[model samples]
Target: MAFADACNWINGNVNSNLTNRNSIQAICYSDVKSQFGLTANHVVRACARVAANRLTAKRKRRKVREFKPTSFDCDARTFRIIEEGYLVSLSTTEKRIKVPMRVSNYHIGKLQGRPSTSAQVCKHRDGNFYIHIQLKSDAPKLKKSKNVIGVDFGRRDIAVTSTGNSWSGKDISSIRDKYFRTRTSLQKKASQGTRSTRRRAREILKRLSGGEKRYQSWLNHNISSSIIREAIATDSIVAVEDLTGIRERTNQKPRNKTERRRSNSWAFYQLRAFLEYKGIKEGVKVIAIPPSYTSQTCQKCLHIGTRNNKSFKCENCGNNCDADYNGAKMIELWGCSVNQPRGSELLSCDINSRATESLHLPYRKCR
Candidate 1:
C-alpha cells in the first residue's frame, strides 16, 4: 500500500519535460514522504529516481505515465548484498528486511567475490519475490587476430559466414508460421465465440504468448555459440553488419501479407545481440561495418554486380557464386580494410588500378 502510494505520487509529479533525477527529487522528496507516509527518505528518493530513469530511457518513443507497485528500486544506501550469507538486505517503507536468495550454480559463480551496492526487489508472475543484484566489472582486453570472419544475415539463411558455415532460417520460419496460424485462429475464436468458449480461448492464447519468442531466443543462443566457437577455433575476429532500423526500412518496400510478416518477424537484431555478449564473455572481438553494396558488389572484381534470387553474377569479372557467400566474402574484405587500414591501403590502390584499367578509366591515387 505504501509502495503504491509512492508510485502514484511519483507519477503525478513526473512529466515529459521535467525528468531529471536531482531536480525531481528536490521538488517531490518532501511531498512524497509526507503524502505516502514513507519513513525512509531514501525510499522516496528511489521512487523519484526510477521515475526519472524510465522517462529518460528511450525518451523519444516511451513515456512513463504510471509506475507499477510490483517492484522497488533501491540505491546504495538502501540495499546490500551479503554474498557470504546468500541474502539481500533491502529497505522497506516501515523498516529494513533481510531476504534469503535462491540462485543457480551459474549465478552463484558469477556473484562470487563481486561487490554490489544496488539491487531491485520485484515480484515475479509466479507470485514470488526475487532480488536482482547488479554486478559490475571491467571488460577484458579484446584479443588481437589477423584473421577475420565475416557474417551475412539474411531471410533464407539466418547467418552465412565467410568460411562456408551457414544456419538456415527454414526451421524458424516454419515455427513462426505455425504459431501465427494458431494465434490467428485463437484470436478469432476469442472475439466471436460463446462466453465459455471465449474464456477458454483467451486462456489458451495467454498460455501461448511468448512460446514462439522463447524458441527463437533459444535457437539464437545456439547459433551465436557455434559462431563464437568457430571464431575461437580459428583465432579470428567476427565482423557483422550494422543493421539498425533494418525492419523499418524493409517495411517501407512493397510486399504481400506473408512477405511482410516474414520480414517483420526476422530476429536478426536478437541474434546479433547474442553474438556480441557471447563474444565479449569469451574474449573474442566482434565488430559491425556498413552493409552498403555488400550484396551488389563482387568480392573478386569489387564492381557492381547483379543478384538474382540466391545467385550472384558479376559482369566485370564474369564471377558466378552464391549471393550470400559472395556477400560474406565482400564483408570479409571490407572488414579487413577497416581492421588494417594502413596495410590495406596499398591493396586497395592495386585493386582500384586494376579495376580502372580494365574499364578503360583514369585511375586516382587512394589516400
Candidate 2:
C-alpha cells in the first residue's frame, strides 16, 4: 500500500542501526520525503516489512528467503508493492519477532512463499511477539510409500499403530472427561442454589473450560506431530479406516443429552487436519480403506472374524495379538482400500478432501 513503497531500500537498510525508536534515525520520515521524495508513511512500512521478512527467514528451519526478483531469472521483472495491506517487524538478528503486530503491505518485492494479493496477520495468546507472514506456499511434503500401517482406534487409548507404536489420547480424554465432570458439577451446584459461591463456581468452571480447550489444541498438535514423525520413520503410507457411517454403526455413551451434541467435538477433526498438513509437509501419502472387520482380522495371517475375546486370537490362523494392534491394522487396511465419509458421531467440521473425509485414522477420540 502507501507504506510499501520504500521496501526496496529497507530490504538492504533494515538492521539494528535503523530501529532507534527512542533516538530518531538519519532516514526518518523527513528524510524519506526530502531524500527520495517517497511517501513518509511508505518508508516506515517498507522498513517494517523488510525487518519482518528478515526475522521470519532467520527463524525458518530451512531458511528459505523471500524470492528476490534480482536473484532469479523470470519473465516478470517486478511485482507491484501493496499498501498498508500487511507488514510486520522482525528481529534484525537472533531470528526473533520483536513486534506484536504490524500492518500489511500488498506490494511485491521478494517473499519467502506463495504470494497473496490480500493482507494477512497472526496474533499470539502466548505473550511472545511474532512477525506474522502468511507464506502462500505450503511446506513441501515427502513422498508416500506403498507400505500399509495398521491403526487401531480405541476408546480408552488414543491410538495404537499396527507397528506396536502408541501415543496417549490421555490428554484428550482427560480434557473431555474433566470438562464434562466440572461443567456438570458446577451447573448442578448453581441449580441447587443461586448463592454467590455458586456464581463464582460457575465462573471458575468457565475458566477451566478455556484451559481445557487450550489443552486439547495442544494435544491435537502433539498427536499429529507424533503420527507424522512415526510415518516418516517407517516411510510408509498411513492406512486409516473409512469412518463413514461409524455413528450409526456403533454405540457411544455420552455424559448427558446436551453434551452428546458435541460428541465428536474438536479432537478427531484436529488430528486428521494436523496429519494431513503434516503428511503434505513430510511428503507422506495418507490412504483410507474400508474399516469393516479390521479389528477382527489377524495381523499375522490376515484371517478375518477371528476375534473371540478382548485378547484376540485368529480362529482360522491361530495368531495371538494385542487387540489394539489388530484394530489399528484393520484401520490401516481400510485406509488403503477406499475413501469413507465421516461418522454421524463426529460433530466437528471435516476439512479433508471429499475422498479423505471418512478415512479412519489410527487415533481414537478418548472421550
Global lDDT of each candidate: 0.82, 0.55
Tens digit of lDDT per residue, candidate 2, span 85-177? 434333221232323234335423435244543232223456543432333556665564556566565555666887788775655666677
lDDT per residue as tens, model 1, 75-150:
7778887787688777766688888889889988988988886677789979898877787787777888878899
Please list the residue runs of candidate 1 whose C-alpha ends up more than 4 Å from where it truly belongs after superposition: 13-17, 34-45, 53-66, 277-283, 301-304, 312-321, 343-367
Per-model TM-score, in order, reads 0.82, 0.54
Worst 10 residues of 2 by lDDT: 70-79
